[model samples]
Target: MSGPRGSLVGQQLRVATTRFAHGGHAVARDDDGRVVFVRHALPAEVVQVRVTRGKAGDRFVFADVEAVETANPHRVTPPCQYAGPGGCGGCDLQHADLGYQRELKAQVVAEQLSRLAGIERDVLVEPVPGDVDGLRWRTRVEFAVDREGRAGLRPFHTRDVLPIDDCLIAAEPIIDSGVLRRRWPAQRAVDVIAPSGSGSAADSESDPGSDPGSHPGSPAAVLVPVPGGVKQAPEVTEHVASGPWSGDITVDARGFWQVHPGAASTFLDHVLGELDPQPGERALDLYAGVGLFARALADLVGDEGAVLAVESDERAVVAGERDTARVEQLEWRAERVEQALEPLIDGGDEVDLVVLDPPRAGAGAPVIRQIAQLSPRAIAYVACDPAALARDLATLADAGYELDTLRAFDAFPMTHHVECIAICRPSSAIRG
Candidate 1:
């Protein structure tokens, strides 16, 4: 296919990958020295790539590995039959060993930090506690419904849905729900959530029958979206145990909860460890979905201190308020973090600690600057995108906050997605 200058849409080229880049692509230079981002490839591997996107004038082109002439030692056969080129685009590194997947993820985080934030540091991606061999860890999945009424996942960068029987990364309950078996001609997609909590927090403390489908081995909830309207999702309880703290938080089934079973508890441990919220200290939990950090902070800070949580999702705020109603020190605000921060900043309300768990697009510059202005003793940033994290870290540095420590976790296995918890402190604290 040819365009104004030259489009490499269907062109084939043989290139040797040089290194791993962000977004799960391997960097390689074609004969013309134009950069090519090859998917399903590894560093130092020679592979045949088919250009999927880009033009001659573009700085880089996106390609898929058509054939591997020389495979890397870490390369392994993909467990899923629909994980390769022109197949399901849900997973990226399924062809590589699980351990190697973490190594590549670490490299990507380090590269993003160096390139975007001008901070060079070796990063290690640790595996979360929950998955076995990086399989069946996804507690929630939304499958798209095709024209034929079949449920499946879409390919990378396309809306075309490919029907599949199973997803290796999905939790067993999600598959057991028989979501793919049923056909929905009127619905666009189906969302399934399998709460992995054994109800250690809810079941032991309260009646086991309080929350249905959230018991130790209950079936997953299959939600078929109503056409032209929202689905009134049921409330599901999630239990988190970290350090000396263990409790349950109720969230809307379709709300923002960690898809990885171990992600919430693991991140809570790290965040608490990073910012040791002392008694009589104020804290802020931005983008606090169901007040996960707020509850923990309020527990440690006690009634003498305060913890304010801001979440744009009204449903999440309502649930959080209801669940944590006994904690008098914790406050819930149903507003965007940026907007909420504005009032706090203008009112000169300084917090001793801050926890930022923004969406995939990071907190951006404005929010970072606002948070930095609060001059929190310590800030914990939980980021899912390294590139976005790096950009915000740069802004934080400019605002006189320095990175104290960073820990990366392979929260989403099989895919290139990695979670990073970055701890930042004021320049004065670092200097001391």
Candidate 2:
């Protein structure tokens, strides 16, 4: 309940603009010094809001949407059910028009680089193409268990569970899971293992619908990272993929993922298309999880090509390695991709290319330095959070690499979330 700035109990003001944070919201001021955070608001929006929480000297104020006095022309209606009840926090930009959403996201990238990373000049590449459906793409999701033996999503910033009628963004089968209705408030964790017909109690009821049906011959499960307070933790976990292309992908019920399956594939296709891997090239896949692109990269490298699949989560890395055996030369090691650079790049390995598919926060400083020091011939970076991406880009560019390709993709249709992939190469290329 403590917000940035002073105590604003009675402050009333009109919000001028909406920016994406936890989600899309309008910004406003209460008197001087203190800023207010409002949800369901847009830029150039006029509305009176009451202060819900406040803090002093920090930054902004946080408040719920009261009313809309003036609205921006770009604002549009959201289509997803449970979009606001807090059940489906999946789509954050639904209220904004598609084109307008792209513009706001672009601004976010630029600001993060300049303001946080301290890099002033950057070519904010045009956003990658966007998808329209914004729903039914999620392969992994964790839900809550209520007293009524029912499960659903908890409200944002609160533990109040709102049972879902249906999740538009969930893969068709998972959405129809009886698990959604049968609340299993285990005092322990639930593990859904990959490759069906395994021996487990949950497996008995998993049914055909629960199977993600991902990639062929891929082992390992998509273990949902739930909090540590269920009663009995299960022995085996499951890896859920929307399609038959599985490798082990996990998502906390509230964590972020591409809302469009086709879009994820599209981005993957772009990476595969551009890199054009040669047989002998060894790649460093930073922040690699579930080894999506890592797997594809390993394949391209063939028997001669080795991929150093680095990830922070030990389980995920193990799973990724186990699954990547399909490609022969792929190796998995558990380490914070953003933090571990010195030891990994200590001269033993000759990594020709570097790839990073980071989460929303983007890559911190350490990994960025390695990419520079190793000075790979090419670096492919996939980012969900534009601000963090911009910040990291500033670091890489200053380290002497030149930005060669910049493309953005809009995977989350309704929300402000967008994905961008950039390709960087050495400052000087050898002339043929």
Candidate 3:
């Protein structure tokens, strides 16, 4: 094999994978004692690696397993054929068993906390309710369109699209939608969503007391990104019947919604329990996408209390406004979180509780300091990335806040992504 510059890419070396690292690679050391992150390999396994990218002065290089001379017991054949080296990058930890995957994720979380925050805690990753052996639980998926109009996924770290008949990790509705078989010449990417009540195999066993009759009206919503913007397909209403709040959330087929079938309810229940908002308290829901958390906050605080939701996305804000319109106590602000937080903090309104579900970037230190200034009795942070969460938590620590409770969930099975819910309180309160 040759590299991009006609350089030899088949340079092989033997190394034993020591442990799992963030972003799906397993840690190993090269002959020169430099770190080598090997793909398609597992911990404690002896593998011959083909260097993908690296040079002498570099701190680390990346490689793919040429041959697994020794395999770990926890290693399993990835369910998806396009999951190994030079395959789809959608699911990284599929090579490991489901239980081992969670353990690896917990280890990554603990390492990030200890390294970044100088704090350590027992990390437990609870499984979300749905998923048949972690095979088909993704309610949303995006496929890349190749030049020939073939709909497929991009290979690991490359723009090249690999066509396939079906994605095993996709929910039943998405797989049955026949999206992979379709052509999208004019589109760069296509998004598929399996809203609630789609009757997918994962949703076969409905929760007790859930209105099983509420259908999603469509098996899956297919959206295509066009030249001007995203061309919307049919809209889908996601029904939620979970702790404290239950209703139908209307979202544009292309809008942001939890991809996991059980994530919305699971995170909501956990956050509500952690915050334990009291009636007549003022709350702020930052990065409130479609008002999922804001609606629940409004219910917890009641009519006497007030909840403000801030979001930068115009479409999401418009949808959030419509969804929470009946709740007079909740108001949606279509502005960036950092921009809106300053004025609210300066307004002298006492914020009792704040729930922020930021993007993968996580809320930076500036935003965390502003939130600390609000002096909310309790703050709930929902994070999709552990490293970003750890950095922000360290920043909050500098502002005199202590991490009270933290919980991690296996929201994205078969992938390295894990969701964390962190509760923080003033250090004085902890000392009191």
Q: How many clashes (backbone N, Cα, C below 3 Å) per candidate?
A: 0, 39, 0
Model 1 is weakest, by summed lDDT over 10 consecutive residues, at 198-207
Off by over 4 Å in 2: 1-6, 9-12, 18-23, 56-58, 85-90, 114-132, 185-259, 338-344, 429-432
Q: Is candidate 1 or candidate 3 better by TM-score?
A: 1
Error of 3 at 354 (Å): 0.7
Superposed Cα deviation of residue 19, candidate 1 (Å): 0.4
How would you encode candidate 3's per-residue C-alpha lDDT over 1-432 as one tens digit per residue?
Answer: 345565434668899999989877899997778899998788899999988877656788889988888999998989898888888989888889999999999999999999999979989998998888877889888888788877799888888999888898898767666567556666677667778843222111113332222324433544434322545444567887678778887776667888888999988888888888889999999998887888888988999999999988888888778877788999989999989988877896569999999999889999999999998999999999999999999999999999999999999889988999999999999889
Could you give me the TM-score of model 1 versus the true structure?
A: 0.93
Query: RMSD of model 1, in Å?
Result: 4.6
Error of 1 at 218 (Å): 5.2
The reply for model 1, stretches above 4 Å from the true place, is: 1-5, 197-222, 226-228
lDDT of 2: 0.60
Best by TM-score: 1
Instruction: Work out candidate 2's RMSD over C-alphas.
Output: 6.0
User: Cα lDDT of all candidates, in order?
Assistant: 0.87, 0.60, 0.82
